[model samples]
Target chain A: MSEIRWDLVKQNWVAVAANRALKPNDFPIAKMGLKAPAAGGFCPFCEGNENFTPPEITAYRPKSQANEKGWLVRAIPNKFSAFTLEGELVKTDSGIFSCYNGLGEHEVIIEDPRHGVEFHDLSPERIETVLNIFKERYQDLSSDARIKYIQIYKNRGMFAGASLEHCHSQIVGLPFVPQENSGLPKYYRDNNRCLLCDMLAQETASEERLICKTDHFTLICPYAPRFPYETWIVPQRHCEHFADINEEEVRDLARVLKKLTGVIMDCLDNPSYNLVFNTAPVNVEPEAGYHWYMELTPRLLVNAAVEIAAGIYMNPVAPELSAAMLREIMS
Target chain B: MSEIRWDLVKQNWVAVAANRALKPNDFPIAKMGLKAPAAGGFCPFCEGNENFTPPEITAYRPKSQANEKGWLVRAIPNKFSAFTLEGELVKTDSGIFSCYNGLGEHEVIIEDPRHGVEFHDLSPERIETVLNIFKERYQDLSSDARIKYIQIYKNRGMFAGASLEHCHSQIVGLPFVPQENSGLPKYYRDNNRCLLCDMLAQETASEERLICKTDHFTLICPYAPRFPYETWIVPQRHCEHFADINEEEVRDLARVLKKLTGVIMDCLDNPSYNLVFNTAPVNVEPEAGYHWYMELTPRLLVNAAVEIAAGIYMNPVAPELSAAMLREIMS
Candidate 1:
């Protein structure tokens, strides 16, 4: 039976099935220890674990010996990569739907050879080095005119499908801009202002739902949060490329990140979460009007049917309450 | 460090941070349990649970007494609804951004007060009765011209975030079409063929990736699945409205659902899953050219940073293998 309900804020539809209401105990928290470290002899990113993965494409170490150690950051080909080097970008039409070869580069960024260090735990110097690496890699990959967009992200824990037990992130370059990327930028072009900046301003002015604010960055739980406890970190200024961040801004970004993670851990009992960076297209210039920002989503509730069915969000906790909870922990 | 890898098939960007890899065990799964069911002792959806929720909007069975006994299905207003009947649809332009008042209806459909009954366990006659109920309520909600879309969904386990232990679903009607729904359909319109239809055809043609296919329906793990063991149940025909389904089709739909849920239980040790339906917009005719179907995604893996950053998907197991593994499970 359908007793129809509409989420007014999100304007999404939901039909609650009366036959399957669930209690808290019936649900299992995502088991963190399910995946042990890959047991394939040696890990490619580790100090002595070079043989386990494909040859390293790049590394941040003194150009002394061939591959004998002393690397702060390393780039290696993924052993079980989803995309690879050989295929050409050939598009074939099948009736009305068009598809092409699953070709492209899939590489892993190994932050440190030491197994358990997370991105937030990295020293400020190391974090800056990682930022520089991102800029360098983006410039190199964008040289291929076929590539249209580059996406950078980090999966933190088992809930985020990180099979390996190392603190790392992934970079993917694509041959086309997704509908979301293209459409989002179009909104910017139409309004002649950064969408996120506008949103940040509105959130700051309201202040009722503000979580944390600083000179360089602002963190807030979006009013229409797609997931519960979803937080966004945006620059106070309208900047397109993440790589364009100055040294001072990078440190600010680092501080923002540390505080963001700290709040999440304190508020949600250190729940597993994912952090993603959304920036402008690789080939685009600073004036292209894309907003670069990071979104950190803690896996508090299991997202199943409602999210998948409707594009609208179902955040049970009101944004005001969510902000209040996070604010308490932040202080 | 970021290695921007491009998924040639999906044509989306992916950022691979090998140096920033997260081990599987780093995420701690929330312990499974039932808590909120006993809270305050005013739970309305439970047997004699009528006092906890709002007054009934609709009810089935026993028309003799006024809301007294033996109701097969009951439709009632949500206690803490996201959308309230009191607000007006006042759209305000704040600078350049668009926002509106949270105005609409939110209700719950209580299937059976008895706990522990999975939807698949319901008799076919009972399932048909439920279908009739769905149709009746949908017609009732669509009477208001202001409502644009109606959504129906069921979240099963604690992982799926069901607050109560009783079996039920919620229905919410909205005033606007979501971005994804409005945008994804554009692809279908541009191609003059349903987007999902073409996708289903490809998977059906390649039976190796097919999980279950009947005359009316076909279920398969999608190629380039966003999450592992993600399965889709699509109608064989191009029916946009769920209400268009006849008696036989409803029976078949239930059968397919039961089979898939059985696979999920057996294959992944009864992992919690989300069952979502994407149907045609309420009040809108079927000429819009989109197909209606359900997406069954098991909470097998948390959506990490890579997925959120890049719209591209990274499925570890091939769909063919996943389908085969699922098919082997005895329902």
Candidate 2:
């Protein structure tokens, strides 16, 4: 489980997970983009090694038992979760600092049962199943009054912070809305327009930063990317929540994601990357200005002090160039 | 040099450094935290290899000629700078996007001629010299009307994004104030109190999070630290600019920094770290609420999607515990 603490100076909440020292393997010494060791030996996410992990919370194993080997996908609680559901969500003051019990849910979505499979190699059907699980979890977690936001993300390689060499994604249901989402609702209230929608219209129209487009989705390198070869997969229509996505959107997203990720792996020589889902908070009423999107950042370079101190990013590769390269590869 | 791009969607500015791909050495494939390859082979930052880099911008070489091997500390324009002084500082709108010619200064401060020498190993007098160079550069750059903020940071070890093995620091002058500093002045205006001064009072009074204290400065693990073992060196008295540091403060800071960094290396077994200096923007009038500080973050864990998307940090090691460990080691 984890405890949430309020940063008095920065005015933000920090989740502190316990038992981090117990998992020494999570902190790798290797440079991030290298191929992680195959999970053939003592792999927890492997189908037969289900016993190594905590019991399954939910799985798409229609034909097999709850914790059996016949599942295409599975969901389990993170063993060393940053936030947990054990303690009551009570806020306490320690001098000038405010802290809450580590009260939230942390779950891992096993993309596949294979030992060393990557998400791009997964079949569209399997990816769709993963998307379905994400939506299901988002909906279920939103029902809890205590959970304000559910963050869904995937760390592909060691550099992107993937401790286990397995095809998996994480879902953290937090007790408070993250700082990034705080100003979004107000923007919608003031402008009556979705910021992403306006940007997407311009990006697609220019076609300079657009990598690919499908019926329901558009993929483009962001104008001001934080990392080199940073890409975004945005829904064609404005949608506030990931759970509100339709079946067509899900299927299209799966196909687009598979193609885009394959291109990224090929273009960047299989760079370590992080894929994050940005959606509106559950507690807030869905607003027109809030649009759900996914940002894919390739870990091509290391972040230095400028990034940490100023919140300013220095990207080496221009988005236009990266997008042109991806477009050429896709063609 | 670097080009500045505006992220209309996120409402932030990004610096895009060009010619990055030409320098493959900047992107190392070896595992982080490992002893980088020694300075024996074609080390651009080494003293004798002055021809390998651009001519020195400024150096402390009193006995030796310019571009010669006689300097103890040297300053040079970054060969592959993210932002440069080559362009006119003009912002133009392209559709919904705004971009400016990357019109700023980027310099590298060679801390020592020896390769693989960490900051903690340096003598206090040498550290003071380095601090003097930083203040000198800050004061010099502030005279340029085009520059707003000067970011001083050091990326040590491979994971901390130090591409070169030699001990050095970077200074980047930007055309605009970063998003992180934008709120502080307004907060000060509204509350009529210096946020950091209040924080220092609370932290020093509590003593739980205080790692150490000198006559001029206090080192404490912030109550809401974004990373594990994150520490800040804050001055005892309120100071808005790094250039305002006096001779005595510089000497004390050098001593405190040496001791604190040594404690960190001892406690974390020489973990990769990033050290950053945060100060008020030059364009703004100095305010009582704005206090200058330096932050040191150890790269103990990898940041995944939740951190990137939500702006929420999950620190596994609590500040209090880490502070206590450092205090114990110091004793």
Candidate 3:
């Protein structure tokens, strides 16, 4: 029977129709459509092609060079940024419409020095270094009084909206907090507890939707996923912002990310995916009942009109089945 | 300069970055990838293949018959339905999760008899008949005490999520009012006006985003569109439900839909698009502020993680630019 389930945190309904009978083997591997870059293709994030991109804001380098090469991980301004750090955050209203000057930061984090190495292939400690850089950027951007929120994410493949084929992540500093985060306050008001912490306890204890777990972090398939095989990595401890992540938590998160991605890649053969961070905003109110988490949604199917209009996500495969398959594959 | 605009109705932010410099010609024609079914493939919606589907609930035929080859338009239960009208609408809660038994209706409206002919190719009179049938279905589904909302939409081409190549639309009778529609009450409380009514007046008066207008309806590019070339066809009258549409209004609406879709098809080179209808729910309150409208979103680019997570839509081609191009092309 199909079940219409409510997502507590996202505040949306997901219709899980198990009768669709989509087993693990039935899913299409999106990486099959992903083409490798042409031989000698000019990738801006490549070591020698650093001149093609904006100068590095920060880099993990042994030498004192800025952008000329020899950096393990690099961070630079996006060439085609959606937001810029130039204008004042002045808001204007015209009848029913309102707008703000897009005064924020958009930076790209190049994952590795080698062009072909993906983030999932890197060791957990190496990934932890990248995680540390994300935390540093979050903290650094938080100090900017104009910025209200920070969004960090990775679009992994061509199908996942990655313009550049090179493996890189993006950190966007937004002038205002988004309306989608209203679920935080809604959940907190309804139940005087941290949303993700409660969800993490529920998901782990149920064990039906548990994919994998580490010392500090646990990966679980959400009960009401918007997409099939949608997974979330929640920390065991309650934290308000991702920038507040400690070194040990970062290490465990890195380990959990690598393990979960490995299992998902093997399960669906490296499907085009989006890795998104969900954290508390810098200058937002009701700051106590927020918990930071990460969502990894594999781009398996296109969302139809019903999804775009009504916010009713149609997930054919049940999360319990998907989590069971993921656990089996991981073992 | 780029601006982060607020969408009053959708409660989301749209960052319009003209720096990306996407003009009318920059978008790719998604229909280039949309292949006609096959030389001799079996299409259930075809004229002689009436037996391939479930018996028609209702169809427009010259003579009295249930399922026949002479039907112009047909409505039938979805073969692989997401919701079935069976069992009771029982709501269950466990821990932080809540769910309802999927006891609702899902129907397919085959638009035309001929397989080669598309909806855009239909004459205004012919399209009006389809609109009438949609209204009839809406009214019929409203009588179901368990159903709460009826979402009518057309997912055209492969990218927009049409499984079969037959030109058709779907009507889903959901058991609950979707959470995306909170804007209706929010608008009423904040401004003491209907959202679409105010937006219609603003767009028509400004003329900056107006694409076309008719006696009973108007088509305009929205202030903060989620995707580039996104358009809305809103009725001029202040009706809460599309089911309340009169004969004259339906005829004018058909004309408006035809003209707008024709302009959009020409503009985007027959892009794969989703045609979604937004109206009041059947079994919900605060319906005074609701206004019925139709949305047409052409699928041009894959939304990245920032869009999926933070609900910040990135539209490279500003609505003003797209609307001007559309008007110019229409003239």
Candidate 4:
């Protein structure tokens, strides 16, 4: 079991997972991104090299068998799981210090069977299949008593933190809720409303920061984005989790998400980016406090040393301006 | 005046300053770091090219005039400052949204007149001179009621966010204290003790994560670090700010910091890194809540897509192991 150590100063938990099996010297010579796919190059997530990865947990197969070449997408346990399935989560508090066993699940959803394929290349139907699979996985693991938060996010390029060139999204069932969702519950307590709901109302009314709106989703550039082209996809229904999103909503979301990402790729010249699903904790109580959404942040600048170290950002571009550019490109 | 907008979801402020004058088109072609300094490079911070930079705010001049040829170190307003000296800081709140004018100070401390020099290349006494200038700047503006926090940090390599090849550190005086300093006040209210002080006691008592301890400073690997080889330098005197340190303490810190950076460079193959000073807000009330410290984090890895997008981190290396390695290298 991995140990989640609580940072006394950060007031956050740091999970020390041994699944990566990294040595002390690995830090000095860690190579990122995939090698060229030509000339006998091997990739674990590729079609013929399925044996290099852990067995498939689930897959969307139309003609072939599990872990076979016919699959369009598949979910596998992370080779180095940050949180494993077999562990007892026992919180230990000594004075002001606290820690717990890292007891949950870390899985990867390989978006495409073909290596080096980008997300935008996938059809809306294929993206819809991926979303459906993600929903199934969320609903599948929500019943587990140990898991509290599930984060589903994608990293597109090396600068965006993708270690491999294969198109994949990660799903991690954490034992506790990370601070990203704290605002919703707190806003509900203070204002008796969902935070994103009010934000949607404000952005829609103004439309200054609005990029585009679909039947079920509203995409807008957040008012205070840390990144240059940071945008959010908020569901109009104010749902608490992605698992709760219906079939129709999922289809609409797939279209909205696909178009937005494509626009970003065209506008930013295909910059590295991260896409995250901000869902409520598993079985959030008084669920009106939360409104689940998807956030896309482009890694526009490479010099984030200041932002990373100080946690203070000096954004060169305004969200209003970025939204206008995105809307222009989107049209 | 630049605008500092509040993020409802992140519960943080985002400053949009014109100092950089970055248009939306710049996002597609912004190059980080610097070109090779070989072909008679024109660095505004270089010794002979001082006229290219904004006029000097202050400098350590045993010879030559202000912004002139001979100076070990100098402080000047950033050519594209994130915050500025001319603006009326006003908070505007409507419903749940809030914003303020980006009215503060952003200065660059050219640590060396020579281009492409590393901090470790400077002598301890020379580093002490730099530290003294940082303290002088901190105390200089701390009296202004509009300024609430001061951040002094260095981004060494391109990966670590340095835009120029010249050796330099940044000093930003903000109109508000950032969330980095929020933990101290919260802990003080709950525990009636400084958080870093308590952490120091635990790390010192165990010495498992201790790298090196001096009379005035204790350098240790934080138990929970977001980055690989992250170390913290906590002052022993329980001071609330770096400006509060004495002359002897400054000299001691300069020596300790120099040694640590040297060891890190030697061990990590001269990895790009960020060093930050976490000082308290100006004139903190019931000052027991804060303790000043410096943190050094190596940019050993480039894939921060997950850490940046989601606030969760899975640190593969444990602090104990990293500290052991550092100690071994130092010995």
Candidate 5:
């Protein structure tokens, strides 16, 4: 589990995920494609090698035992979690500074049983299973009064910061609402309208940066993307909470996600990318003002000094050009 | 030059520094140490190869002609600028969204004539020259009423986003104050004290994460560092602007910076790092409520899904431990 500390100067929270114990040289090179076997000749998430990992919390093993070989997908507590299930959420104040004991859940959803397979390579059924697990976990974690936000994200390659080669996504239940999402609620209050919904309508009507559209979802390169080939997968209808998504919506999202990932892989030659789900904070009921979405940022460029210092992003490729390239490849 | 566009949804500005038409495959591998010669066998920043870059804005060439070989340091307009000097500060409104032409100055400060030498490796006089040039440019650019902020930053290696291996730093004059700095003025108004000055006093008294101390500066790994081995060099006095530094302060800064970089390089084995100068916005006079400092972040870890999505950082290494390790290496 991770411990959250307050940065007095920046007025933000910093999470120290100390369980990983990664040293300065522990970071792996940004390698693409398949990864070699572990030193012990074991892949924990593999079907038969399930014993290598901790026992399953919940798994889709209809044909087999709880922690058995026939499972297609598995959800387990992250071994090197940033936030732990243990520890009391005690906030301590020293003068003007404050810190809290990192009391939250960190779970890893093994997307597939195969070692070398990627998310896009998984079958639609498997992808749907992954989405269902994510939704279930979101609802379960939201029940906890201590957990305010649940962040579900995936890192596909080395550059995207995946230490393990196995296909997996993470769910981090945080103690507070993140700073980035702090603006949405106020924006909603000021305009009685969901900002993303308005932007989606404009994007769909313009059809300039639109990559693909489905009955349930709309995928487009954002107008002011921080990175090249950055895409957003948003629901056509406004919804505040991701857990509120229905069965039909889940299936549609899975299909659209597969198609979009395929397009990105084809266009960027399997570039390393990160997929992040942006849902509303917990304890807040579904509202008309806030809408949930997922943003996909391909790691084509490195963020350096200017970005770190000023919080300003300098994108070398225009969003219009990236969208056109993706569209051409999709056709 | 780069163009700035307003992201109405996020309520932030995005800079499209599209002058550098970098392709998807243009990003170089994370190469360490000295770079190999380019295929053209010409380094654009080398003293003799002045023609390869845009004309010099200013250079310390007392003995040679302008744009000739004998300069210790040079300042040139970035050929691949994100913001140009030509555009009018015109804001256009389309529905709820707003955009403005990127009307700002982007210049590159060639730190030294030698291609392979790092900033710390340069002589103190050379480093002082670089600082002087930075201050000169900051003072010059702040005179423009349209420009509100000037960011001074250096990306040292390939992973740190340096396109070329030659030693250089960048100065980007922006048309507006960045979102990150917007909180400072308000915080000052509410608290009646500068946030950084308060932080500096606490950090110095604790001295737990202190790396080094000088007459004019105190360097420490911050209490809540976003990255491992992240360090900040803050002046003891409550100076709000970098341009306000006198000659003695500049020389002291150059000496302290060289020592700190040497410590970082020794501890991390020449890891890629970014040095960013945080200063007061233009037209803002020096005040007790706001102070300026430089933050150094080494690119030892790759930021991925969770960090990008949540705006929360989960650092594996603690600042105290990193500072202790750096202290040991320094000793």
Candidate 6:
């Protein structure tokens, strides 16, 4: 089983395990397309197509500056980046105004060397290796004084916003931590309890809505689900950082994730979905409470004006019903 | 010009204006061909379709019975709501346990007698009438002592979760205000300044990102846009609630909205989008340093794992560029 940790500074939860699912190849097989490719035909992430993207920032390849030949997972600068790497993180406040230059590193982590191989489809060993790489990157980025937060996430399938078919996630190092994010951990501190930990215990005890569970983790459609089929994967035991899980936990996580994905695929005829690992900021360590976890949002509804107007969500299907349906399908 | 009020409670800004541009036939037009309709389709809110849903609690039609439909905008109970109407709003202290019932009202607002038109395409006069209806509903629902907040919003198109193409937003009156929402107002009170006011001032002053402006409002792409082409419409002056806006401002809003929609349709090639209004809570009255506004999110990018995990938007195009493009195409 994997351990979940809540990052105090960033207020995100992450799962840490060494025995990650051994089967990454199934990642691609479960995806159903809800969106089409970009109008232009060029896909920069594919193999034999190194020229389409900016120069590689870093890669686990041979020391060749020529092309994208010898590489496992590579990191490249985004062609259409929101924030470039050139600016300095200069912070200045004009009276009550406070802001800094949008300076930091935004690098894309390519998971597979080949095209059409999503993360879940990667081998278990490869998945573990990928997890290690993520930790290493987190550690490396935290060392930089200017960087306040490091974000890692993958967009699979067309609906999940995969510009390219290859499996990958992008890591962004930001200069300033977002205000809402910073408030989350403080909330835990003020309440004298870990928000997620308390919530998880309640959800677990109320097993009427449990979707699936593994040795290390439990997957359930949340009571206050922001979207229909919004499944949350929380660790049975609370930990904080994602980079600190053991091998057994990782393996358990892999098993659980595979099953969760399987259930999703089996039901809803393979809807487009997003899988996100919410870990704490690089600067903060796990404390007395708080836990990290994964939130899976299936694109079952469109987020329109009303949703934007109110922060509250309007999930048509009840969480209990969704859980029941998922359990039945998984069984 | 519409007044932009900083919500002292929600920490969000909203514009109160009756200035709206509504052509008689103008309404949100759903894209053709997304999902397969039911085998034997039925209009769930129609007069005879009462049996299709759970017994309605309140209806406005020639009320021989409450559920019977002669109402302009019908409010019926959600058959499969995420949150139930039952359950006590109990906050127990079971050794650091904190979980509340998913207890709240989830009512669907059916817009038209005919099932053909969306809210966006309705006549200006008709839209104003709908706004009145929304205001009436808010006033009525918020009076419930159990309800602390009333959220009003609409979803258009299948992408936006409109089960029926008829125009309407759902109202969910919660027992208590959510933490994320409540914190915004607190931050405002502590800082003694409006967060959105500062944001809008910075954006308007930048001029580089300003898209379109009406006497009552200014539409600009946010500086750090969470999504590509994320346009925000704000009133030039500060005000609070959406229902409090005068008739003139509504007309101005209608014009600006029509122009904004035209630009989105023409410039982004009529991409699917979500329009959300950020307003103050039900109990909160208009106060200094609070503002209300509308956010238009064009679904240009699929918000996948990276965005969810990192809490940062990866915009493919800069706000400046997007604004310029929109300015070129909009009315």
Top-lDDT candidate index:
2
Off by more than 4 A, model 2: A18-26, A30-40, A86-88, A181-190, B18-26, B29-40, B86-88, B181-187
Q: By DockQ, highest first, what's the ranking?
A: 5, 2, 4, 6, 1, 3
| TM-scores of all candidate predictions against the true structure | 0.78, 0.93, 0.87, 0.95, 0.94, 0.73
Question: CA lDDT of B313 in candidate 4?
Answer: 67
TM-score of model 4 (CA atoms): 0.95
- Alpha-carbon deviation at A236 in model 3, angstroms: 0.9
Residue-level lDDT of model 1, residues A41-140, one tens digit each, is 4455677776676777777886634455778887776665545445456655544333455555667888877876767677767776777677677677
State the DockQ, from 0 to 1, for candidate 5. 0.54
* DockQ of all predictions against the true structure, Cα-based: 0.18, 0.54, 0.18, 0.51, 0.54, 0.20
Lowest summed lDDT across 10 adjacent residues in model 2 chain B is found at B21-30
Predicted structure with the largest TM-score when compared to the true one: 4
Per-residue lDDT of model 5, residues B91-185, tens digit only: 87866666778788889999888777888898888889999999999999999887888899999876677777888999999887775545466
Candidate 1: docking tier? incorrect
Tens-digit per-residue lDDT, B1-331, candidate 3 = 2222222212342222212322212222222234356888678889988899999999988785779778888999998676668767675576776555666788999999888787888899889989999999999999988888899999886557666778899999887777555676567777788888887888889999898787888888776677667788889999988899999999888887787788767767666689988888887664567788888988765667876777666656667777777778755
User: Candidate 4's residue-wise lDDT over B309-328, tens digit each?
Assistant: 45666788777788888877
lDDT of 2 by residue, A201-238 (tens): 99888999898888998889888888888999999988
lDDT of 1 by residue, B1-331 (tens): 2222222112222222212322222222454343444545444566565666777887776553435566777788877566654544565564443345555667788776555666666665665566667767777887876676777777666656565656677787766554334534676667676677776777677666587778798887654444456677888888877777877888877667666776576656666667666777765554455677777776655555655445444444445566777766632
Which of candidates 4 and 5 is the stronger one according to DockQ?
5
Isolated chain A: TM-score per model? Answer: 0.81, 0.93, 0.87, 0.93, 0.92, 0.76
* lDDT scores in order: 0.62, 0.80, 0.74, 0.80, 0.78, 0.58
| Candidate 2 Cα lDDT to native | 0.80
Ranking by TM-score: 4, 5, 2, 3, 1, 6
Better of 2 and 4 by TM-score: 4
